[model samples]
Target: MALVLPFEPNEPSIEALVALVKADMERVNATILARTGSDVAMIPEVANHLISSGGKRLRPMLTLACASLSGYRGDGHVKLAASVEFMHTATLLHDDVVDESDMRRGKLAARKLWGNEASVLVGDFLLGQAFKMMVEVGSMTCLDILATAACVIAEGEVMQLAAAKNTATSEDDYLAVIRGKTAELFAAACEVGAVLGQRPKAEQAACRSYGMNLGIAFQLVDDALDYGGSQAKLGKNVGDDFREGKITLPVLLAFRRGDASERAFWQRCLEKGEGNDADLDQAIGLMTRHRAIADTVERARHYGAIAKDALALFPNGQAKDALMEAVDFCLSRAH
Candidate 1:
């Protein structure tokens, strides 16, 4: 079947696709609220602050969408979606604290509002709720998948911490980092849908492939946006990653290709953390000069192509079409 491009009429907007699952999404939202409530007032207060913050809920939305495609007729998908959301939310809460970020989605980060202790505890609470939801589904397949993903995500954060402020990180190391932290959940979210839908192994593998590549592409775009995106889009100041000494693909490529002078520039800014406004500007210029941003976008497009190709196994329909649209949307951020 021919792939449906995002702008094509056959390719529904994210809005229309979300509307298709509106009822299910509502159920997921209710489940999230009920699960987030706690005896300790601080728990709900910190949890809901981040929950209420604006996020597209893309991971859970993917769970619902893939479930629809798999022809799941039970209520399991709703709980699974909620589980996916809680798992994702838990990650975000911990991530902000780890990253020492003060803002999230254009507002003060939950950690900034509440101390790091509350943020960590609330994040732990969310993970507990996520696991409970997984058990409620009584699907061993789902539980194993999500539980493993959570562990890998934690490992990824540790790997990133080890790599931080170290300019010697390779592209392969960077890929491993994103795979564990970001793409693992995406793969689990879609794979669990196939399990719940009872599709054959081949279809489940395809969904997993789609989610994995889509997630890689999504993270790649965010890396690009870190240097190029505005505060409005990124929810944090631009160039935050550089300031944090986090080595991403753009930085990786630029560092590899730079001359002695350019390498020293990266050393001073990223390694020594001695950069100022001019250093950030120079970093961007160096990346541009080395074509790092352009190359990074190219890498993201390659993954996006893989994501679209994974949908080829499934027949052309609204679910498949919307999935393709979502891939296009991920790539569009590069523009």
Candidate 2:
């Protein structure tokens, strides 16, 4: 989603969180830039194409904010934050290849520009760098958290592949796909901060819960936007999910709620891979008729509320306030 937002006078803003972690974020950015360098020319070129693509880098920012809020004074959070970003970047590169996407963050996808082989190999290279940074941090608990997230994210991608183009994919199955693919990394990012702070297990768990819920909300909003938002706002073309036959939450809800004729349309467009530019319009109309996009956004709001609640144990401060606003910032994208 675009980082820019229309003015909402009373809305909570991510600016607070951005200001809160600005210094640490600088360090994380430096680390990311430094790590992208390689003797092989193509590696840095392909990696930097996405790393510098202005995608907001929210995942790494979460790590920094959580660390600051948890009172972590050490520098390990910098390395960990960079690692979180690399993992995310790697996934995006792989995702573009898998989905055969043309655009990302308003530009041609790295896979499209660099070819799938370069994209995948560079993605692997980034994964290696990410793991190296994680190891350098020397926190076993932190390492374990990120390592497990890596594995779970891979499993989630495979799960999504399995569920792709299947109109019968259930809501539970959809949730499982996102939990592993998206939320797992968010959970790990926040939890590792608490680990660095040597906070109590309860606080660590709370951080994980906050990130996990936020990630779910974030993905759900993206799903809604795929059918309901503008291309300029969404970065990628609208109806990308429909064209790719991805079984997202909006499609699942609409498919389950649609009439027999509606079901046939979805089946023909999604399951049978018969969708075209015109089918894209029909798909959006169907989603609107079924309240699919609206309900998907409503579900995001539900998770966003849960994410806010997850931070309840933390004392009220700039850190807490900024983190709270971050959730609002995520939800505000729907508007």
TM per prediction: 0.95, 0.96
Candidate 1, residue 249: Cα displacement in angstroms equals: 0.7
**Residue-by-residue lDDT tens digits, candidate 2, 1-335:** 87987786887778998899899899999999999999999999999999998988889989999998899999999999999999999999999999898988989999888899998999999999999999999998998999899999999999999998898898889888999999999989999988899889999999999999999999999998988788888788888888888889899899999999999999999988889999999888888988999999999999999999999999999988998999999999998
Give me the displacement of residue 315 in model 2, in angstroms: 0.5
Model 1: lDDT equals 0.88
Candidate 1: Cα lDDT at 213: 95
How accurate locally, in lDDT, is each candidate?
0.88, 0.92
Q: What is the Cα-based lDDT of residue 271 in candidate 1? A: 86
lDDT of 2 at 199: 87
User: What would the per-residue lDDT of candidate 1 be over residues 10-43, giving only the tens digit for each residue?
Assistant: 4324775577688999999999999999888998
Clash totals for all candidate models: 0, 0
Per TM-score, the best of the predicted structures is 2
